[model samples]
Target: MCRLLVMFVMFLIPAWALGAPIEIAGRATVVDGDTLAVNQKRVRLWGIDAPESAQQCADPHGKPWPCGRRAANALDAWLQGRTVRCVQRDVDRYGRSVAECLVQGDSVNAWMVRSGWAVAYREYATAYVGAEQLARTGKRNLWQGAFQMPADYRRAQRAMQGEDTRAARVPPPGCRIKGNISSAGARIFHLPGQRDYEQTRIQLHNGERWFCSAEEATAAGWRAAKR
Candidate 1:
């Protein structure tokens, strides 16, 4: 009877949940240059990495530019309300699907690399190396400027933020909104009394800040915490 019960449970489990390849298709919401949400599930584009939302890059003359936010905006425009189809290749530590996505039959991952908004994530895959080379040679968007690799920038941010995530600094009067950067590098803001609000720490030097209102946070490129 126990063996029969185990078999029944296994039968009820989804193939994808059992480690089969999963594919999701829908209108996607852009989360950043190399991340999107399809059907409310976060998907990280495989084989590429884009800058963080607040990261900056230097132009040819050495002036700082908001390359990270520009990358996200460019990608959003490129999608143009089209449907996205993502095929899962793996799952990241954040539980996000690492996928090779397509829009209008063109590879979104390749496009990001080739357009110079993202770099080939060679640590995981070499499939977009050619695309990266093309972007570099053509001097595409980010290629036109001097920018730290996305991974390196993230590492530097983490190092500067330190291990102490305790919220020791008090917010300004009537400006209690907390802007926090996630381990995944998303800029999310929490309101007072919201879940994670009490626990979220603001590292001012890390580009996290306090906003007086939701609109101010959104305008500054921080999304509201889902919870």
Candidate 2:
């Protein structure tokens, strides 16, 4: 039962779930840079974000390396043979529990940001700002090189997926709308001028299909992008 669930979430609690926050502790499974599965609950560290595992970043020179994988590896190393505990702080749009986690009383969130394996998610909280500054100043881990901000990387990935419909100057026949699956498994549609339109490359191999109109997409079970 506890072993079957998996999740990814982001920050700041609503007034209701704050008091007597859910406390979870267990062996952890690393889902990504900032996500962990503890007691079978997918817990997203509140107020921090790590690069996606597939993302590549460059140094000052024109070079490319797997910075995203590095971030994930850093977290995995930090969690090795350790007991992880987290207090649920909130719930995200994706239904993941947003929490501040610790390993042997050390704030895992703080360590990740301070060590440059993660960044402060300013959109959520200011608790990790000081640590983030230290990481920036020291040029530790991810701070040592040129990398896309996690949020930007996500947007670009989403956009790139949208460009897969035709892969040419023109879209395939009438399938101009881009239907991309997000990391959360949501089906999103991208149109011209949308953030992901030009970058999204449709993948027919992934069961991703194309639509011709907003109405057609809506009818086929896709929603428009909020951004």
Candidate 3:
């Protein structure tokens, strides 16, 4: 009986260790609320979604601005010059590796949700539901004011891109605008005197429209182009 027990324990140990931990070291370039580029490979942090640079939600003052930047800044400060360890889980639709990253022994994804800089992406996994709920109740970070769900934010973005047929079917008249793209075969028109000319350039690609003044456009969601 002792010999049999020893063999069973050995077999269980190998199964537990099937997925060995891998350490990847690189500088992080934040892509958006949930993604980063490490050594040129895209990595989506598991269990969280940070706002996009163009995503607008109100602040504590009820004013709107690019809220995603704060999350990015937090991530940058947390891992800017440090080497991080990423434990892989799976790959996402965008071909990004989904993983939990650790910096200085802290779970980066959990930190984002706990601080309210991001929402828990429960569709992929439910590991951090409690942390996300805590952040929501605490009204931390992006949760301080009225904000759209991350999934909704992404859906809105897809609609703006004409990717979602249902979203494309509806014209965005008074809705706050986000980012835009312009390319060959697409013509976008704008008033010349618009104050948000710079933002228009960034948010109103070649085929979208903003039926408001430039100031309104800026408030709505257009950001000045980076020099």
Candidate 4:
């Protein structure tokens, strides 16, 4: 009966504790509101999400506010160059350790959420829900204004970047010849050694391209520069 009880206790032990507990401690550098680096190791505050560094929010009057940088500055001032200790809870997809960090015995993660610099990341953990509720009710920091969730903001930014990348034009590899359409509607191809080649710019959106050879350029209805 005693052996069975011991086995049951072992089964209930946390997986992270079953092995050596991962603990990092050092003077911290604030990477953002919910992230810090100690001894050059990145640690993400667990159970909370802060605005991205470039993200913006709206104030009560609907004016744009740099809430992202504000959150980062708030966390930095709160830290005050103190040593931070963090215990690893999990590893995030970005290779950062998701941790519950403490400074002077106070939980940094709870402070961020409670102070409204960050929001409780309900998708991963609900431990800070009460603190978040209190912050919201009190209209602290971000709670006093309108802002998108950090994750949603990141997704929106990524979508915009993807569309921009798709709309951009790039020259093909080894195609050093520039095909330009003059103002007079003449299709001209500039070679590497030609005089105007240095000044010629290919605007792909205006139906320009880089040609691999003069033959190819002429075949595509572009005449070589007279020079």
Candidate 5:
């Protein structure tokens, strides 16, 4: 009887914890690619970043309004005029609730990825990476063209805000620059004027300046042209 009671309590605990699904009813206003406001309460979706309304990207017709409008329209179609279920998670840094929303029995995050409107942001490349990979390779939605990666896009935005100072400042040729490490072991330094410069410097200065891949440096607008 005691064992049976323990099992029953264990089962009941989860159900009690879940409780009744609270229904929040409101008109969703898309704040950005991954955020929405429901009746003034901001909610950041689990995974996604739609184009900004002010973003200017040419459409197939060489016209504007395709990228941002398409993102808004997708969200509108998914949730407009319909009730959604929000499984609340922790509050994000922006004070908005991070949540997995459900519309018509579909996971909103999954839907966004499947539709190619958003990418699964896997910092450590978890299961969601597969979905993002497939979406990118399949050229679904935003992946259909030469759109920048969401990470790169965010970096660009932060650069505009003067945050990514390294990328913003152009390093002088033959000068050394410091960089952060990927695994926190050592810093990396970029030394100019060496044949195996990047690799050699990366090995010696394991903790100072990371060897910036050509792509990374280029994205940051750092040119490697000789003096």
Candidate 6:
């Protein structure tokens, strides 16, 4: 924003302008259950959150299943040989586009939640509440058995890793991400070129693992360290 525009918005204007939603149409690659890659842009599905690829949760019977991976596979099955269309909402902190996407005229995000493979991220939006309620009423995916909410699962997993402090967060051979435990009991991935990246050391026993990209780390339930 221009300096004048910022000042105007802060002091002179009573309302802020909202950008018109953008439309992206193309073939897409499934980044995960809730994210897509279209025309070289990352698009996070709006209003829903899916399990991380490496996350595990118990079934109604208390048996463990790769629910996260299952969610990804479900999305892949839904998108196979299909073209994707997305209406952009905003850019996320990571700079990826957040969007409501459609495949073959069906709302992809809504389907995921309605079919029980995902949950409505109420922290973001309530647009999918009806679909989510239906899934729950039908004892759908995550509801079919007891499981942690996606965000809660991520938070708890990071906390466990952080409390261990016994292993290194292995960046690929040249990856400079500093996997460090935070006081909040979170395993934080510090990227290369950040101020504290060099000072953070790796410990082999803290359940440290290597990730080739930030996407991989995030999909595996790790969060980036704050600047």
Off by over 4 Å in 6: 1-18, 166-227
- Return the TM-score for each candidate structure: 0.68, 0.67, 0.63, 0.69, 0.53, 0.66
Q: Rank all candidate structures by their TM-score, best first, as comma-separated numbers.
A: 4, 1, 2, 6, 3, 5
lDDT minimum window of 10 residues, candidate 3: 185-194
Q: Taking the tens digit of each residue's C-alpha lDDT, what string does model 5 give over 25-140? A: 46677776667777678877765555655554544445544666677678777776676666665567778877777777877777777777777766522435666778778877
3-122 per-residue lDDT for model 6 (tens digits):
989787667533224344578889888888899889898999999999999888788898989998999889989899588999988779999889999988899999999999999999
Q: In model 3, which runs have C-alpha deviations exceeding 4 angstroms? A: 1-22, 163-227
lDDT of candidate 5 at residue 122, scale 0 to 100: 68
Per-residue lDDT of 125-188 in model 2, one digit per residue for the tens? 9999999999999988787778889999999878876675446345668778888778798989
**Local lDDT at 21 for model 4:** 69
TM-score of 3: 0.63
Of candidates 6 and 2, the better by lDDT: 2
What would the per-residue lDDT of candidate 3 be over residues 1-227, giving only the tens digit for each residue? Answer: 99999888877785326676555557777777678788888889987778887778897889996777777877777676687778778778877788998888899899888888888887888888888889889988788888888789878887767644434344366643333544543333344444554455433333455444446656655553332
Q: What is the lDDT of residue 227 in candidate 6?
A: 78
Candidate 2 total steric clashes = 16
Candidate 4 vs 6: which has more lDDT: 4
Scored by CA lDDT, what does every candidate get? Answer: 0.91, 0.84, 0.71, 0.90, 0.60, 0.83
Model 4 error, position 59 (Å): 1.3
Candidate 5 RMSD computed on C-alpha atoms after optimal superposition onto the true structure:
12.8
Residue-level lDDT tens digits of model 4 in 114-140: 998899999999999999999999988
Sort the predicted structures by lDDT, highest score first: 1, 4, 2, 6, 3, 5
Q: RMSD to the native, candidate 6?
A: 13.6
Estimate, for each residue in 1-227, the C-alpha lDDT of model 1 and write its tens digit.
99999999999999887987899999989999999999999999999999999999988888999999999999999998799999999999999999999988899999999999999999999999999999999989898879999999999888765543433376777899999988889999999999899888888767788889999999999999999
Any idea how many clashes model 3 has? 4
